[model samples]
Target: MLEALAQNLVYGILIGALYGLAAVGLSLVFGVTKFLNVSHGELLMLGGYASFWLFALWKVDPFISLPAAIIFLLVAGVVFYKLLFGRMVKLAEGDKIQNTLLVGFGLSLILQNLALQFWTADTRSITTAYSGAVFSFAGVRFPLVRVASLVIAFVLIVALQLFLRRTYTGKALRATVENWEAATLMGIDIQRVYLLSFVMGAALAGVAGALVAVGYSIEPAMGMSWTLKSLVVMVLGGLGSITGTFVGGIILGVTESATGFFLSLTYREVVGLVLFLLVLVFRPQGLFGVKEG
Candidate 1:
């Protein structure tokens, strides 16, 4: 049982890093813009699919394709901003949420089905030389690719933390997160912040997609699962807190591992929902989120 627990924990943490990557971006978009991007997962799927096609046809490695993926998502984000988000802001935040949710969810369905139509819903994975190597420690075996992806996720979280703490535009995003009304009053272009933040968030999702393509099955409808998981992370971590997202993700990871070990694999996913409720019941503000910072 102990050995099985260890293995589950290992899988959970590595998987949680990817979940953190998903949630952090989703949380940021919600924090500043106050819109829950329901279709955020589809972008992740798009990222994976983007790399898959490029790797298949152009012989490009996804690690190398990361930049192109980021750029593509960034452009896609900006286009969405210009075509959709910018217009929605004229409506109230509540209206924006309703409109964006409808539009984004619609887009997600379209993307998922379209992917099935084009790709045939087959599970696809990248077969790089490093794909099959596993590192064993004590009694468990850890795949190198999963480890690499976890490292990338952690690095991204830290780098984004540093960016938010040190840079000008990052500061603007923080300011916007803190108090949108005051930031608008203090000469910060909330609109620009919204555009940039949304774009950056989308870019983060793109990177996650690339990483996932390295290790997991790629499909059109996979985004819904991820999007739901990210929502749990965001709520548990506190919607506007980057650090909170990390804490929430790690907690969910450990909880999932524990549950999956002792209980049935059938209940593995239920752990996230349970944790979400447990956190909200105890600390509605989230693990690391500040109520009125």
Candidate 2:
């Protein structure tokens, strides 16, 4: 029983890394631009498909094809922002949030239908020669793919942190997030920052999707579920703290894993919603979020 529990815990942490990666992108966009891009999940789905096709056609490894996925999503993000979100940049905060929500939802629906038409509603996953390989330690088994995924996720998250902290554009982004009007006064281009944040968010989502394609199954309808999970983690970790958001993802992953182990598999999905509700009612600022004045 202990071994089983340990195995579940390990699995939780592995999956949690991905949850964190997915939420980080969403958090960045919301924190920087205040535009809630609800279509983020669809972007992830597209990433997964991009990887799937690359592997299916050219026999490319999913891991090696990550750059392709990132590039694809980056271009898609640029088009999306310029066509839809760019116009809403100057709206009042309240209007920006409301309009983005509606537009994002509509975009998600359109993307979903397009995917369905192209992919035919079939579930897809990437299975490499080593996909089923695993290693055991002290009676617990660890899948090689999942472990690699965790490492990759951690590396990407750290790289993002470094980018934000060490690069000039990153500093400008932070400044804008802190105070867009003041950033503008300081000669920072607010529009450029917004565009960069949105594009980066989409790229991160693409990475998460590629990882998911290798570690799990993806379908056209999977977008909303992943989007909600990202939202939950974002709230749990709070805004403006990427590390906190990543930890929040780990917490949610472990919670779901434990619920599945002790209770029923059916309850795993419900547990996240329950936790989200509790957090909202008791501490809307999130675990790491600073309360607004």
Candidate 3:
């Protein structure tokens, strides 16, 4: 019984890392742009498909294809910012946000249909040489791919933290998020910063998707569930808090794992709904979110 509990903890942590990675991009974009990219999940879908096809055709490993997914989504993200968000930013604040929502929702629909047309409704996954391989320690079992993904997620998160804390552009990004007008007065090109932040978010989502594709089944409609889950993590962590996002993911992972063990796998989504409600009723600002003045 103790060993099983330990295994559940390990599994939850592993899943939570990926969950955090998925949420970070959404959090960052919403923080800087004040616009929720509802199409964000489609970006994950694209990344998964990109990795899937690469592996299917060239025998490339999913990890090897991950960079390709990131690059592909990065370019798509920048283009999205330039075309849709760039124009939307020109509107009045309230109007801008509302319009962004409508446009993003439409974008998601379009992408989903496009994916269905191309990839069909068939589910897919990347099978690597190490797929299904397991590691055991102290009578506890760990999936090797999940462990690699967790380590990579941590490394990426730390790298992003350092970038935001130590780099010039990163500082500019934070400044812009705090006050775009002030940032612009200080000679920061707000549009460029926006582009960079949005692109970074997309890249993070893509990387997470690629990692997920190695371990799970992928399909055109799979993105919506992940997107919703990512949103939950972002809210749980506080809308724009990087550290908060990771912590939130960990909390969610453990909760869902415990629920699944004690109750059943079918109750997992119900647990998510419960968490959402609790957060909304008790602390809408989220665990890491700051209260609006």
List where candidate 2 sits over 4 angstroms from the true fold: none
lDDT of 2 by residue, 1-293 (tens): 99999999999998999999999999999999999889999999999999999999999999999999999999999999999999999999999999999999999999999999999899999999999999999999999999999999899989999999999999999999999999999999899999999999999999999999999888999899989999999999989989889999999999999999999999999999999999999989899888765
Error of 2 at 273 (Å): 1.2
Q: CA RMSD for every model? A: 1.4, 1.0, 1.5
List model 1 lDDT by residue over 114-172, tens digit each: 88999988988898888899989988889998898888888889999999999988999
Which of the two, 2 or 3, has more TM-score?
Answer: 2
Model 2 lDDT, residue 192, Cα: 95
Question: Ranking by lDDT, best first?
Answer: 2, 3, 1
The Cα error of candidate 2 at residue 21, in Å, is: 0.3
Q: Write the per-residue lDDT of candidate 3 for residues 75-163, one digit (tens) a residue.
A: 99988888788898768879988999898888889889999998899988888888989989999998999899888898999999999
Worst 10 residues of 1 by lDDT: 84-93
> Pick by TM-score: which candidate is best?
2
Relative to the true structure, candidate 3 reaches a TM of: 0.96
At residue 16, candidate 2 shows an lDDT of 93
Q: What C-alpha lDDT values do all the predictions have? A: 0.85, 0.95, 0.87
Clashing pairs in 3: none
Q: Candidate 3: RMSD over Cα atoms?
A: 1.5
